[model samples]
Target chain A: MKCPQEFVFAANYLADMARSRSLEFFRGEIGAEVKADTSLVTIADRSVETMMRDAIREWFPDHGIVGEEFPVHNPDAEYQWVLDPIDGTYRFAAGHPQFGTLIALARHRKPILGVIDIPAMDERWSGAHGWPTVHIRQGRRSEVRTRSCTAVKDATVFFCSGIMWRNDPMAVWNGMHGVNRLLDGDSYSYGLLSSGFADVIVDSGMKPWDFMPIVPIIEGAGGRVTDWQGMPLTLDSGIEVVALGDPALLDDVLRRVSAA
Target chain B: MKCPQEFVFAANYLADMARSRSLEFFRGEIGAEVKADTSLVTIADRSVETMMRDAIREWFPDHGIVGEEFPVHNPDAEYQWVLDPIDGTYRFAAGHPQFGTLIALARHRKPILGVIDIPAMDERWSGAHGWPTVHIRQGRRSEVRTRSCTAVKDATVFFCSGIMWRNDPMAVWNGMHGVNRLLDGDSYSYGLLSSGFADVIVDSGMKPWDFMPIVPIIEGAGGRVTDWQGMPLTLDSGIEVVALGDPALLDDVLRRVSAA
Candidate 1:
C-alpha cells in the first residue's frame, strides 16, 4: 500500500469518466459479440475501455494498461492501470444495473489503488495503498470497515454466479453451497462485503480486471482476497478467488471448499 | 383481466405507502428474528405489512387479507389482498436493494391486480386485470412487454436464489443450471421477465404473497406464470413456480425441469 494520493484521485476520476459513457448505452438496444474466449462483449465495453485508456495515457503516459476488452499495453512499466469497463456484461445487457466499471493501479505487479463504480446505481467504492476504503452513493460518502465473521458456520456467503459452480471444482461448489446462507450475487457482492453487510465471496473465471480493483477495496476494509489456494492476489493470480471479511474464517472456508 | 381502475389505483397507492415505510429502515441497523419457518423476519417486513393491511381493511372492510408476516384475515371473502412486505428479506436485511414489497388483489382466489415495489431502488411494477403491464422508475412509466424465446437453448434464465436449488427437486436444479445462461436474481427477476430482459425464472419455497403479484405482472406482459407443472397459479398453488416470457418455450422448459 504505497501508492500516492494523486493516483487514487486519478483512479476515481477515471471511473467517473467510465460511468458517464456507460450510462449512455445502458438499458438501450446494444449489440454484442461472442468473444474468442466465449464471453459476451458489447460495444459499451469497448467504448468505455477506449475512453479510459485515452484518459490514462493523457494523465500518465508512462503508466501501463491492462483491460478486459483490449490488448495489454506497455506491460513492462512499473506502474499500470487495470480496467474492466463493464464487469458484468450479461447483467448489463440484460438491463440489470449491477454491472460496474473497475479501475486499479498496480505497481510492480501488485495492485495498490482500486475503484469500483456502478454508474447505473450511482454507487462507487475506492481504496488505495494508505487510504481508508469508502463507499459512495448519491452525494454522500462513508468509510467502510468489514465486520468480524468468526465462524464459517455462521457466515453468510455469496457465490458470484451459479455459473461459477459449474466452473468450481465440485468440492468447492459443494462447500460453497454448504455455507449458512449462500446467496447469488454478481459483482454487487463485493460492495456488500466492503460495507461489512456480508462475510465471504468465492468465484471462478475472473480476469485481472475483474479481481485487481477489488483487492484494495476489500483489503482497505480489513478483509483478505486471495486465490482459493491462499495466495495473495497479483496481476497473475489465478481466477478462482476467495474473499473473507474476517481473516479468522479463512482456514475453515478453505478447508471446507478444498476438502477431499 | 377484469379489475376496475379504482382497484389498480388503490394498489399503486398502497405500494407508495409500502415503499416509504421500507426505506425508513433500509441499510440501517434493524433487528431481525428467526420465524418458526426458519426464514429471516424484520421489523421492516412487519411494519410494511401492517401498514398495507390497515389501509386495505379501511378501504375495503369486506376484503380479505393474506400477508407473509401475518395470519390470514377474512379468508372467505371473495376479494383478498395478498402481501409480502419484503419479498427478499435476506437481501433486504443484507442491505441489498433487490428486495421488494409485493401487493396483489385476488378475486375468487385468482389474482387480478399486482404491484411489485422496490423501495430502495425507487422502482415499481404494477400489473392488473384489463390493464397493460408497466414498469415505473423515478417517476417515469413505460409499458413492459416480454420478448420471444423460440428455444430454451438460446434463452437467458435467472434462478431466483441459489438457495432455491438446494430446496428444489434435484432434477429441477440440474434443469435450471443446464439452461443456456443462469443468473442469480430474486423478485427482481420477475420484473426482468416482465420487461423481456430475461426469459425464464424457476423458483421454490414461495408463499402466496411470494408468487401472487408476479402472476399478474408476467401475464400482463404477455408471459405466463404457473406451477412447475404448468398449471395456472392460484391461491392454492404450490410453492414451486416457473415463469416464461415466451409461452412457446414453456413446453421445452417444463419438460426439461420436470424430467425424472
Candidate 2:
C-alpha cells in the first residue's frame, strides 16, 4: 500500500512540532516520574505528545492516536497515528542527545509512514510506503539504504540494554558472541541500520509506540524488521524484535538465537 | 600539583587540530583496516594523530608524544602528551557521531591536563589540575562538576563494552544490577560524568591513551578515577578502571564488584 504524500507531510510537521516542544525541557531540571510500567516519563514527553495530539485532532478529526504518554484515542478509526514523543527518556533525562521523537501513520493497523527525529543532533529520518527512506542532518538531506551482509558472524549488531532481556539474557549474550556487537543505541540504532552503518539490531521489551515508527523506515531502506522468530512486526507484535540491514542473514540469526 | 596554563592551552590546540582532521573522514568512505590486535583503525585515526604529533613536535620538541596510531616520541622527556586520535573507532566507522579525540598532558607520569573533543557533535570538554572542569558546546562554555550520588545502587553507571570484560563479565554484570547502567559511551561517558549527568563508569581493557586523558577531567570535576582495586590510576595502571562522581560511593562499588 502506497502512503499518500499528504500523510508523509503531516508526519514531518508533527515531528517538527514535537522536536521543538521536547527541546524546551531538554538539559533543564526535569521533574521525571516513574510510570506504572517502571519506565521514566518527563514533562517533555507529555508536552510533546499533547501538542502533537492536538494538531492531529485539528487536522484529521477521525484519525486514531496511540502514544506512549497518553491513552489511545479513536481506536476504531481506519487511520491511526502512533507517537513516541521521546523514545529514549532515560538518555534524555541524563542529558544525552541520542533521544528522539518517533512518529508513524498506520492504515488499517499497518504502518505506511514513519519518522525518526533527533532534535538535539539536528538529524531526522523519514520513510513511507513506496518511497525511499530519506535522512536530513544539519539541513542536508539524502536518501539512505541498508547494506548487504550475508552471514550473522560478520554482522555488526546492536542490542539495547541487556537488562531489557532479563527473561533470556544469556540467549542473546551467547548468541551474539563472535559478532561485532555494541550495546545501547536505543531507537538511534535502527536509524544507523537504515543508513547502512549497522547490519542488525536485536532488541526486546519494546512497545507499539517504540517499534511501529521504525518499520517503514527500515523496510523502505531495504532492510527487514521482525520478531526473533522471523515474523513481521505489526501493531500487536511481541516485544522481542530483530532488524536486519541485509535480509539474507535473518535465518542464520534466528537459528543462532533460538539454539542458544 | 598545578598544571601549567601553557600545557592546557597546547592540549586544547592539539585537540582542535585532531577534531578537524577526524571530521574530514567522518561519514565518508573510510578505508578501515583491522590492526594486528584485532582492533579497527582508519585513515582518520592516523591522519589526526599525525597532525597533532607534528604540531606538538614543532611547538614543544622536548615533550614526549604517545598516540594510539604511532610510536612514542621523546619518551624520556618530563612533559609527555598522550593522545587517542580517535576513540570509539567502531562508532566513527559506522557513521555514529559519538567518537572523540582525547588529549592529555602528563608531567612526571601524572596526567595534569586533559581534553575530550567530539568534532561531529561540536562539543569539547577540558580539565586541568587545580582547575574546574569546563564543557564547551557550540561556543557556550560552562564549568562542570560531577553530581553527588553516594550509593552504588543509586548511581547512573556507564560501562564501555561487555566484550572487553571477557575476563570477568559476570562480575561486572551481576554487580551492576539495580543501577541505571548504560553500555558503550567510550570517552564520552567520562565527559558525561564530569558534566554531572552520569554518576559512575566501569571499563576494562583500556590502554594508556584511552584511560589517561580522563583521569584529570574526572578529578577536576570533583570525581574520582582509579583502578578497580581503588588504587589511583597512574601511567602504568592496570586495564581495569572505575570512575565515580561521588567519592563516597567508591567503597560501595568496589565491594559490590569484588563480592560479585
> Highest DockQ, which number?
2
Q: lDDT tens digits, residues A1-260, model 1?
A: 46798998889888888899998877655422221112334578888999999999999999899998789999999999999998877777677777889999999999998898988889998998788999999979999988877877667777666434553334455675545465565567888888887888877778888889889999999999888789899998876778898889888878775672
lDDT of 1 at B22: 84
What does the lDDT read for residue A123 in candidate 2?
Answer: 95
Q: What is residue B201's positional error in candidate 2, in angstroms?
A: 1.6
C-alpha positional error of residue A174 in candidate 2 after TM-score superposition, expressed in Å? 3.6
* lDDT to native, each model: 0.80, 0.82
Q: What are the per-residue Cα lDDT tens digits for candidate 1 across B1-260?
A: 48999999999999999888888877765422221112335567788889999999999999999988888999999999999998877777667777889989999999898898888888888999888999998888999998877788777777665434553334455675545455565788788789888888877778889889999999999999888798998999987788898999888888876772
Index of the highest-TM-score prediction: 2
Estimate the TM-score for candidate 2: 0.93
What TM-score against the true fold does each predicted structure earn?
0.91, 0.93
- Model 2 misplaced regions, further than 4 Å: A29-40, A162-164, A167-170, B30-40, B162-164, B167-170
C-alpha root-mean-square deviation, each candidate:
3.4, 3.1
